[model samples]
Target: MDIRIGIKDSAREIAFDSAQSPKEVEEAVVAALDSGHLTLDDAKGRRYIVPSAGIAYVEIGSESTRKIGFVA
Candidate 1:
């Protein structure tokens, strides 16, 4: 899954890839917002934590495959 996190006052949003389902990610974001902290684990086992209060939005979408070479 592809996830993008918008932070308050930040020009660029945080983007990452995760193995978690959309529902799971939404639940985690809600839980973090309620608890004032957000934690996420990526597909590579890397973890990320941020302040929930600073989160502007959370975007979750399906991953897209990158195409190489030219198509006719």
Candidate 2:
């Protein structure tokens, strides 16, 4: 899954790939909001923690399904 995190007052967004399911991600986001900090792990095992107050938006992409050729 691809996740993009937008920070307040920043033009560049933080993007990473993870293996977490949609439900898991949603739970994490909620937990972060309550705890005041967001923590996430990438596919490569790198951990990212950001202050919840600095987060502008979170865009999560669902797991990609393989497709062949062009649309007809």
Best by TM-score: 2
User: CA lDDT, every prediction?
Assistant: 0.91, 0.92
Q: Show where candidate 1 strays beyond 4 Å.
A: 63-72
Stretches of candidate 2 off by over 4 Å are 67-72
Model 1, residue 11: displacement in angstroms?
Answer: 0.3
What count of clashes does model 1 give?
0
- Sequence-dependent TM-score of model 2: 0.88
Quote model 1's TM-score: 0.83
Residue pairs of candidate 1 with colliding backbone atoms: none
